[model samples]
Target: MGVDGVFVAEPVSNVLGGLACLLTMYVTVYRRLGR
Candidate 1:
């Protein structure tokens, strides 16, 4: 990752993973609240 072109894909993967995690947490909380 040291100045290599491979580092370009980092942001995309991070955004995707973050969105997935956020959605999962939202669903979990909603289910627990029963709303």
Candidate 2:
């Protein structure tokens, strides 16, 4: 069960982490351009 849980959590964490990174970059870029 621990291994299965880790497997499931990994993909979800990756997706959320990717999304957070994208959002952070987008906001930073948008702020810098002042648009």
Candidate 3:
């Protein structure tokens, strides 16, 4: 159970991290374009 939980949690955290990185890049581009 613990190992299964770790596997599930790892993907979720990775996805969240990926989304955060994409969001940061999008905002940076938007700001640059806005300027």
TM-score leader: 3
- Every candidate's lDDT: 0.88, 0.97, 0.98
lDDT of 3 by residue, 1-35 (tens): 69999999999999999999999999999999999
By summed lDDT, which 10 consecutive residues of candidate 3 come out lowest?
A: 1-10
The lDDT, on a scale of 0 to 1, for candidate 1 is 0.88
- State TM-scores per candidate: 0.71, 0.79, 0.90
Which pairs of residues collide in candidate 2?
none
**What RMSD does each model have against the real structure?**
3.1, 1.5, 1.0
Maximum-lDDT candidate? 3
- lDDT tens digits, residue span 1-35, model 1: 56555676788889999999999999999999996
Candidate 3 residue 20 Cα shift, in angstroms, is: 0.1
Count residue pairs with overlapping backbones in model 3.
0
- Candidate 2 residue-wise lDDT at 10: 96
